[model samples]
Target: MASSSMLLSLFFTILLFFFLSPTLCANSQGNALHAMRSRLSDPNNIMQSWDPTLVNPCTWFHVTCDSNNNVLRLDLGNSNISGSLGPELGDLKHLQYLELYGNNLRGKIPDELGNLESLIGMDLYNNEFKGKIPESFGKLKSIRFLRLNDNKLTGSIPRELANLSNLKVIDVSNNDLCGTIPVDGPFANFHMESFKNNRLNGPELKGLVPYDFGC
Candidate 1:
């Protein structure tokens, strides 16, 4: 009879863990947003509603979450924010739209952002970001719109971007990007205006020349 009582207690503990573990896991999404809030310098206080003590980040302004409370979008565009992005932003695995344009953000775009497999539109234009676009961005299979224009970025556009069949619009203009632009897949439809003001050697020549022709 004592052993039966112990078994009942153990069964209840297991049941309680299953019931509470989801809330704890969802709270981590809030934690990820709070981590991001702590990193950026929000001068306009646009993120004033991002209270970390909340059960989840669904209540935070500029942050969108799904029905299950998974983070979906972050609309922090033109908010006069400064500082660079960090890897913590990658924890929002369900994120789809990341709009961070027209800010004072600088430094290399974090490679961890490529881990956002659900990303659809990544609008990071009109910032002071520098360095090569992360090659890991090739992993963003769900991406549709990629606008990285008007930055200080250099180096040949990564050829891996050519694999995104779902890509519809890509604007790398007004930067220092060099080498041949990928003319394969959806890139074949993008006009020269999408690639102007860069050191690009023009489109790829298939078998005649290499993709990294200029730089």
Candidate 2:
């Protein structure tokens, strides 16, 4: 009788854990957003709904959540919120769109953002960001548009980005990037204007002066 009771208890415990997992994940997503707000300077007070006391961020403004309360997008573009991006952003595993373009945000682009496997579009253009593009961005299998133009970024473009088969728009113009432009995969369909004004010498030459030509 005791053995049967113990097995029943274990089963209920496992079931309870599974039942509460979604809420727990939602709480984590909310925490991640709160952390992000804490790092940025929101002079407009537009993020008033980002109270950490909330159980989840589903009801928060500028944030969109799915039916299961998972974060899907961050619509903070052109909000003029300055300050560096936080690594906490990576915690939004279900995030799809990251729109923070045309801001005064400065500092290195967080490598942690590459962890957003569900990411479809990422726009960080016209910011003051610097440093090399994170090579881990190649892991975004669902990515379509990657606009990082008009920043202070330098170094060679990651060849791994060319591996994204779902890529539709790839604009790295008006930056300080170098190396020969990739001519393979989705990069082959991109416009030259996409790579214009960068230090990139030319398209990839199979057996010539190497891929990092001018860098």
Candidate 3:
């Protein structure tokens, strides 16, 4: 027998090059996320529910996947998406839930998204993004739900976010931020609506005022 049919055609050509080399490296990051969705400028077309020929990005439509298909989640909230945020989204290297809430995305927010080191969850809330908040997001230590609430970020709040020890819920509430908010670990069990109505001093709540709770 022709040497067992030449070792069964070299074991099906090494199992078709190990199953087409991880689907050609997950379609080369799904063709760079479909060429960054054609240089987004969605106006108000609201990404027409992002269709890019389905298939990868785990069959599109608010994409979410994992079973080796990669891309975990991308909610696209309040869909009136305006622009900015395309650092080819750090090549979605197994992205974990990125929801752009109340859309109208402006700029900044992208210090290459700290290269999504298996990001847990990031929601860019009530958008109109200004600047500051990107000290590479304290290098997302497998981040656990961080919401940049009511955007227009100013400065200060980055005490390297107290080194996000797998942070469990952080909301940089109502921006134009000032300072001094960094109290001991996890900001002493954050509340007071997570520092609502900024330029904060702290510790007051109950319908603030008295120089907005100048604690």
Name the top lDDT candidate.
2
- C-alpha lDDT score of every prediction, in listed order: 0.90, 0.91, 0.75
TM-score of 1: 0.92
Query: How high is the lDDT of residue 106 in model 2?
Result: 92
In model 1, pairs of residues that clash are none
RMSD of each candidate relative to the true structure: 1.8, 1.4, 11.4
- Model 2 misplaced regions, further than 4 Å: 207-209
lDDT ranking of the models: 2, 1, 3
Model 3 C-alpha lDDT per residue in residues 114-165, reported as the tens digit of each score? 7888889999989988887878778888988899989988876776766888
Writing each residue's lDDT as its tens digit, candidate 2 over 159-209 gives 888799999999899999998888778988998999999899888875554
Q: Rank candidates by TM-score, best first.
A: 2, 1, 3
Q: What digit string (tens of lDDT, one per residue) describes model 1 on residues 110-190?
A: 999999999999999999999999999999999999999999999998888988989999999999999888888888899
Cα displacement (angstroms), candidate 2, residue 170, comes to 0.6
Q: Which pairs clash in the backbone of model 3?
A: none
Candidate 2 at 80: error in angstroms? 1.1
lDDT of 3: 0.75
Model 3 quality (TM-score)? 0.36
